[model samples]
Target: MSTFRSHVWSSVGKKMITGLTGLLLVGFVAVHLLGNLTLFIPDRGHAFNAYAYFLEHAVHGWLILAFEAGLLAVFGFHIVAAVTVAWTDKRRARPVGYALVRNAGGKSRKGLPSTSMIVTGLTLAVFVVLHVKMFKFADHPSVVYDGKEMKDLYAVVVAAFKQPLIAGAYVAVMGMLGFHLRHGFWSAFQSLGWNNDRAMGPLQNLARVVSVLFAAGFLALPLYILFFVDPSVSGGHR
Candidate 1:
């Protein structure tokens, strides 16, 4: 049993956890992005907000707690496993860069995608923490508009995009998230034994389509809020 535990902590085991949890996180991102898109519909943001309020405050609070616990477990395992794999690989490769770019024809950049994963994942972690801090922390002063307090979930979102800096930051983070998912989604399927030469073609195409849709859906939110909606317009402040 002790020996088995050691083997479970091996590099391969770490990679497996990272891949699995990373896939789960991808699903979470899709759900979150879809929910966020509700902001585009007039009065729909409140509906979404109410849904969020219910999840947090209702008798089903324990269910929310359980879900959050599971999410945190997945995230923690994913991060630890990713870091272990990366560190192990780094140690194995003494020299960081190779002299000649070795493109063994038909083979993609050997380490680019893997390294990019770490960078993008770290960037997203920082973004998520800051995001929760901005929106989730209720006591944080509301971004005011027209001498009225704009502090509710809907108002905070509207106020957030009103600032060019905040809007651009979200766009930038979403772009990184898109790139991360572009590689991740297909890789997840491949990991789960779906990789077959006969089906690889269609699978790859499907992955691309899903990735694009995910990116577009998320990107549309800030774009619409910033460009189309006017803060001074009616139905904005309630």
Candidate 2:
């Protein structure tokens, strides 16, 4: 047990955990963003709810519970792995404290993203809880579409975003999410030793693109709804 625990606490183990969990989260956010884009269909979330239903009832059906459970586990693991790795890194770097450091090939050390991961990640974690409570756990009014009556999730979102404060918070949080992801996206690959000379540059570039796309894609939704969508149409959240 001691050996196992020691190994798990090793740098290599922590990095592996971080990389794997980060990959899962990356995939999850991508799918989640695609689903969120459906809100723009102008049907008042009809399609969005249908898609949600399909996942919860028709498509994966019972499997959705398992999937969600797995997602929760992954999210939890990522948080732990990230915090542990960040703490470990800090401890190890202390002896070299205040000394200007350089990475391989003489790149600068500890830019904004690397230094801010734990802070940004914790902020994002709080945002996720609030977001889920506002949308998922909160009661959604009944809505009927295509001869099926379902919860009016669209209305809930419309109501929430209608408040300028809420919308503003979302936008800010999204920015933080992007900032955190910027380093995480590429670092995950590097942690896994995928940093070959030929591919590293392109890979890092791709990661940047992915991070920006996610940030912008998520940011666009709230901004569009706040500036363009008429919240009165969806009625009250409850």
Candidate 3:
């Protein structure tokens, strides 16, 4: 009886952590997307830079650091748990690879969506590191670009997008991220015991909508810079 209770508690504990962490990540992504959207305002590079500067150096700097640390921990745990869950399921159903295998248990097969989640997560991680290096770490040198001695954030953004491959990569990764979140959001809610038949149905639909909106919002910045913005201005600073 004690062992049974322990096992039940452990499973519940893991699910609780997973659900909470997923919710935390969702909040972070929503706020990050909102901030990214600020770049869309024409000739507001200073505004965006100021916003970034506040996040990095304001009185709330320590708070942001704490939140980032928490996010990192949650992401690490989520990945570890996801891998563990996937491996365990695979082992339980060790079957030969067939052209098609269906699980009637309402579980998604190991297919494009699953593969894309892993791949895009990795790709986005790489992009994030590069993004920080290019934007955040770039020194603010006074340069005479279009009679402006400010940091050439506009140039940096345009230069990065000029590479068609990178722009396409961003779009692809964002698409995959949408798919991943479409399933993940509702799953997280369900795990947290918000799974009433009536409520869950509408919530699932809402999750899909929200996920696509988020993906579109994040993807728009690169697309705008790559396609619409005039690169010649400020030496390709969009």
Q: State which candidate has the highest lDDT.
A: 2
- Tens digit per residue, CA lDDT, model 3, 1-238: 9987664345444555556677788888899888877678776355555556567665657967886688778888776655554455458655222111222234443455545665665565676677668776777533333444445565666667777888888787788778778777766665567655566678779877988898999788788888887766533232
Q: lDDT scores for all predictions?
A: 0.69, 0.78, 0.65
> Would you give me the overall lDDT of model 2?
0.78
Root-mean-square deviation of every model: 6.0, 3.9, 6.2
Stretches of candidate 3 exceeding 4 Å from the true structure:
1-12, 94-116, 136-154, 234-238
Per-residue lDDT tens digits for candidate 1, residues 1-238, read 9888775577655656676888899888888877787687676355546555666666657877887799989988988887787787688844222111231133453444445888888898899889878766656323333454444576667778988898888888888887777777666655444455566678668767877898788888888888877765423344
The positional error of residue 192 in candidate 1, measured at the CA in angstroms, is 3.8
- In angstroms, the error of model 1 at 125 is 0.7
- Of candidate 1, the 10-residue stretch with the lowest lDDT total is 95-104
Model 1: runs farther than 4 Å from truth? Answer: 94-106, 109-114, 140-151, 233-238
Tell me the TM-score of model 3: 0.76
Residue ranges of candidate 2 with Cα displaced over 4 Å: 1-5, 59-61, 94-106, 235-238
